[model samples]
Target chain A: MAANRSIDNFWAVIPAGGAGTRLWPLSRAGAPKFLHDLTGSGMSLLQETWARLAPLAEERFVVVTGRAHRAAVTEQLPSLGPGAVLAEPSPRDSMAAIGLAAALLERDDPDAVMGSFAADHVIADHEAFSESVRVAVDAARADWLVTLGIEPTFPSSAFGYIHLGEDLPGVTGARAVRAFVEKPSTDVAEGYLATGAYRWNAGMFVVRPGVLLDLLARWHPEFAAALRAIAADVSLLEELWPTLPKIALDHAIAEPAAEAGRVAVVPASFAWDDVGDFDSLAGLLDRSGAGTTVLGDSSLVRVFESSGLVVPRSGRVVAVVGLDDVVVVDTPDALLVTTRERAQQVKEIVAGLRDADRHDLT
Target chain B: MAANRSIDNFWAVIPAGGAGTRLWPLSRAGAPKFLHDLTGSGMSLLQETWARLAPLAEERFVVVTGRAHRAAVTEQLPSLGPGAVLAEPSPRDSMAAIGLAAALLERDDPDAVMGSFAADHVIADHEAFSESVRVAVDAARADWLVTLGIEPTFPSSAFGYIHLGEDLPGVTGARAVRAFVEKPSTDVAEGYLATGAYRWNAGMFVVRPGVLLDLLARWHPEFAAALRAIAADVSLLEELWPTLPKIALDHAIAEPAAEAGRVAVVPASFAWDDVGDFDSLAGLLDRSGAGTTVLGDSSLVRVFESSGLVVPRSGRVVAVVGLDDVVVVDTPDALLVTTRERAQQVKEIVAGLRDADRHDLT
Candidate 1:
């Protein structure tokens, strides 16, 4: 209940993966978005996530990442013990990634209430974020799969909406989720905002490790069993990780659980961003949302009469003149120039690079 | 006067100067616009100019450049003799550059008729250009300061206009110049284009070396004497060059000579471009001017739904997406991104870099 005190029996489960193709050149396949210091905070997104959760779950950290990134994750988080990092042989989507952490936590500590958060999200109000997680953890202790829903700041059609129902009878600040809606059109999102019951689904969930596995077992028995079997024997990971279904946790458990009146939501009013593209990144870095924003060394950027984002990572001087809302990402081997309006189309460039067998660039 | 055969007693005087601040990063103080191969050709602009003039002037070529660029000019023009490349101590403007070439040619060959052309202009029709030069040369032999007036294709406010008078009765394709107009506004340029008697003065002057100095003697007698004295004693070049008046040939002789009813114009129909800025460069390189155009190493550029010019000089892969009329010049030390409409403002960036003491980038 105390915001400053560490929560009892809480385990922080971080899933650090995603190429983030929309942020190419800055976020490449080998380095990815999570490993980058996109917020200009000196620490990368993964390190920031660890810093935020360390106070809430003291020394109870578990990071599951791709085999290629395991060493980098461990190196970035030196304080984390060798046994705390889990490396999956291949990508099997969020279900396997998060479920592996849950299965391991369920065997290590019987009273562990695991909170799963992505490694690349940015939260402005750390105190507000901590408060929301505290409430979510309390609801998870009651055996409910709780998600920390972000208060919608705009009618963005980019993310799904969580429809809130009546408040939970026992837990304060917790409400029963009425439904989980897929990403909708602008008009649909505007209508949803008018109703004042929708919150942006940021995909942050809190639940007991045993409760998550049990909920997954009810839907797909083999999936939960495979995760548990892999956790029982660490040597079976490489063979079992690829066999698990490649599905998101929302499709595997959250949506169906909400329909069965088992999912709870904590509507938090913190400024949160997944930094989906350069436009989102520009907004996140520049709170005023005007003028040119430099994410790397500001001395490397020379802008005039321009308003947008510039990531000068190549140590070369980047001079932008007379452009409005332009995004330029300069790396050592590749450079990307586009507009904020067309930031989503950056993924197309990455796809083209892969198709052309220029994977070194992608 | 045959267009295919070499003209008798003709010399090609190339005034290779100008830092081209508007084409910054690609055209720097050390490596100016004339040294760059902006046309996607393997040869530099100076080399291209030499190729265009070698057929007409045959071994009678003289290149006047700054002291810093003298070696580069000589290296680019290996066939030119050791005494052919003249290095200026400092930039003393067009009058000093061209007049020194004229004074030297006048002393070396009494019957010399020199055609002075810029080292960075792009000419499309080689035969038509040759024909224009031949007609101008014929008029120059008659002791007239003849300029090749380019037929105006559009109303351009960036260049000066030549007012045409009655045609010369003796020489075909030659017209007496009524006056020389400075760069005008768009509305004024439109009016000039509407008049059939106006032509774009491309600064291509062909004149007998003695007549050009005599024309200069009519107004700035001291300036002409100083240049001739420097030619008489080659060791006095650095000493007397600093004392020469810093004036363009257009103002020093062409305007005053035209007022005295002595200057003539050859109304040539060849397509010519100074490539004054990136917009002009884009138009010159992409005649159709609809899609993205890559200047250097087209294989290093990747584009999608974009139009304009991109120079990938750093051997980096430049990817542009969903931009219209954008200009991206990637160099080893600096990168520039702007729009074609604002390409002229790129000089502001170069100025800023110099003011900030980042001359290494400029």
Candidate 2:
């Protein structure tokens, strides 16, 4: 495995799922977070991800999204061929979703290495991200599951931590992964930050398609077999997808493989964000001091003596006054108003809406 | 003048102006707050006011609103016959708007006693309001400019105070108004409340049409003469209205009249609110403890761990979470998010929108 080596056999598998329930009204069930131009950028997150990967995975892009978002995914990424966007029949969690892509890549390209990235994430430095992916792809060729470990800037308890072992012998900036820990408490996170040996596990994985499936076969034999069988017979997808176990890829393969001393991590010093909620969205906008950051049309948001993020997607004027860290997401059919601190609680609102049988709103 | 006596020639003068800018996005320039049903009741504030005054000033309603909102006023007050709604050429302030009504009544009925009330105010007890008005009208006939003084519930500096003097010789609940003061400081207001000799001057004025003209003539002879000319020739209103002074009735008449011992106050024990801002609006729609008070369709607003006022007029689902004293006003063309304490600062947002020349939104 060599760093900065271009591998023509590498495919970029973008898992465009997640309704982003916490960012309600802006991110709806029909139109998820991946489809929104959340950072006021001209391109949607999915489009931005495609743009970032196009140079490396040119004509090797495979986007897997829910059945409902098939047309939207294709529309957002017009450069991709019709067959490039794979529509899942049902939500089978990350393991099945990403596993299905691996199974398909395994059959389509015998020597293919794949780098899996979520469609809704925001990466600031494209050159750094691509360089890290190239390094991970080189490591993937050596029959090792590789992940891009982001250098933690702060002791953030919001994400899982990736523990670093000894440096991978012959690979630059690549280290063997000791273990992948779950989201830690603030106290534990601060200690990990102090040691300077742990990185934020952003769920970015690069691996050989065949190797990933084989690793899945060790822990989730039926799940791997179902995904491979479906990849073999595309007609059986609708009948088989729901039968697959609902599990995130981290728990299904990455965590287990790391514990067995078979995984490696590439330390990348680039800004990465999942854009999980309004608070993260506010940080992305970066308007410090007391004034609102309008993600949509600036003309549509009027603020005075206030600071926050206002997403006015409904073509209506949004006025925020005398508030701190407030979030006003005005969509056509629904509205969400909350503070950045209370952003996590928005998930409860979505759950409550679902429980109240307001499926149209949820 | 006898207390509680029903006068045959009494007219209800409703000055239905003011864009209610502080309540912006809900109250607009074309469709002001007077035309909105701020309370959950099934009638607009204007309609509710008309209903409350129907018993005494039967069919004797004169509504003064901006030319832009003339049609909406007539539409809301459908029972009013042709020429009942008086559209102002421009906003000439309270004095000119109400003075026009007085001039019209003076010529139509020499014995008419006009009770001028704003169309946007809310009163909890209709019976108590009517009783106060009857007494005010009684005092009005005795050559006194009568006002309804609401008993202070709190030391709110938002409204002006009417200093009470010795009790009127014959009229019950009626006393001589020592002076009509401007909005006082909270400390001074608290002191006035402690003394129990001050009452909230709700701007509800009652007076004989001719007597009001004579009072105006004493101060601004040219202004009174211009109003009389417009009344004598109804066709001259469009030409003469712009010549009238832009002064509130309180400064032009009430304060001076009170100093001259020609003003009387009927101390009414009833809840009264102008619905000035979202804070006052929330106070009016009081739902103590922790929960949202929906002024529109309750089902449209879904609250979780929120205690505030949510006016969802756009027929969309409004979800407020983890906020205390929050004000969410979601309308079709605009939305306002603020806290009750910072509600007054909403005016700055409105001003900013206006300065930006987004008139359609304002």
Candidate 3:
């Protein structure tokens, strides 16, 4: 209940722009994963993300998304103010999307500490997530770029790792980030896990708007200046957006800040998932460890001697029989069938469709 | 070219009434396998069967189908005369369906030699098939209930085996049928294959109409009498159809006649498939041994590192990735996803759907 109180001068910046190609047919260019209710909660992932952050960052939200998705983002979160959603003209990647929000928040509230979380990730235990964000916010007030580090549940080769250093002197449960490592091989991830000093870098960053801009300016001065200029003119976004570098926030600011010893990590024991592929999705939905895990209308799916994921979105009966760990995603126009282990290769199909000039399906 | 010529007084009796539970969604109760184009040949199985037999039977064809499917049968075979398709009041198994045809042929043509072939089977070599039917007809003229025995392509346990006896005294290319063995284990089938005295019984029976009726009478006197009574007076079909025995033709006549040394078989080297399940259906379509054998429009299917059967009948793009021997059948009302190995279990799903009163899907 303590985590329900709104943090003073804190803003939640959500970057909602990923194609999520691995979840093809269900997650399309026109309707990305954030727009879909993958968890059968009757709420899209974007709406769930907004609900989780509203209590802590009450009425202080800035959702940065692609221009094509701006209207959808606003529609999903109707309570937000007029200027709460920032529309990027094109895909400039994570750095430009988040940094632009930081520049605008800095101009509106000089003392604003912004927490940037992706709009499509799944989080369990909202109280623990809120508590971790609270600690990260406290560290952010001390002029440090703080990230909430998730406890590694497995030796996953798909996620980057945050090397944990000594605990911060004054901030409890917050540690200095020794380094931010890229996604490693499974063997290397196992080594990282054995040391007991690495946490999953879930890309949840909290920092004062000025501190983030200054860090970006330290590495790429023009990138920071362009974003600040866009925030100043309000009309310069179209002119300056194409000029900004396309890079993830992790590479643009987090890694460099960690190397410069200005990054802090708040260790949190809460379940978090990017829902990267069908395998991860099956795990998330198959909590009972029983029959097929249906993400959509359960009435639409009928399974016999099968245990995996079936998303029946096209209002048809989906029958899965005698296949284990299979993935079947049925939409109105396109359907995907694969195994959990081979789910990552779905992106190849999407790419092939695009190359074949079947963009209508892609 | 000899196979393209019509045979004198030869009638093709097509019994087109199987649920084809294994090929669900694609083959439903309202639309069985005989009404589908499983071979990607731009024609339904019934149409293909009619085309194959038109040369031999000419206009002498009798297609016995359930009353529910009579309209579809007539629609598929538009060239058939008004009285050619005989609609049974309900299903009384193959015995009643084919026996009624035999009784009608006997009344219409005293010397009619009827060749009964299922409306939903796939034959690769048309010339060889016609040649085999010719030999079977020759044997049928000698008062023998003749069956076409397909040479064993593999040790298949899914089909009944025909035990080949000594050569017929006078009928060239035809031999005595010693016995009919039910589906056996793989090891038992392998032994049957090694002996070189067994063939897969595809249930192609050739015989004079009176001879067939006499053979049926020898086993089930009431069943034969009822069929004859229905044929004598068409008005009695609705009253007597349900009273007829619900048994397969093999059980009612062929097995008993073989035991009495009254059955003969024409050895056939042509390819034949019942298409009983998705695995068999995949084999029938994947002639090139290539990626993803699509039964419907190939343009609607996209595969990456996957091979098997994909039927995209619902006009949806079906994409398969990193799975081998997978079976995906998508229809407008229902969809089926499984592996070729597990395709046999699809019937279990159909049975479950029927049990749950989801007849709309079944």
How far out, in Å, is residue B342 in model 3? 1.2
**DockQ of each candidate's interface versus the true one?**
0.89, 0.76, 0.89
- Identify the CAPRI category of the predicted complex in candidate 2: medium
| Model 3 segments more than 4 A misplaced | A288-290, B1-4
lDDT of 2 at A72: 95
Better of 1 and 2 by TM-score: 1
Off by over 4 Å in 2: A1-5, A78-89, A107-110, A220-244, A287-290, B1-5, B225-241, B287-290
How many clashing residue pairs, candidate 2? 0
Q: Which of the two candidates, 2 or 3, achieves a greater lDDT against the reference?
A: 3
A133, model 1: CA deviation in Å?
Answer: 1.0
Candidate 2 residue-wise lDDT, B165-230, digit = tens: 999988877999999888899999999999999999889999999999999999989999999999
Of 1 and 3, which scores higher on TM-score? 1
Residue range B46-105, candidate 1, lDDT tens digits: 998999998999999999999999999999999999799989999999999999999999
Docking class of 1: high
**Cα deviation of B347, candidate 1, in Å:** 0.6
lDDT of 1 by residue, A237-269 (tens): 888877899999999999999999999999999
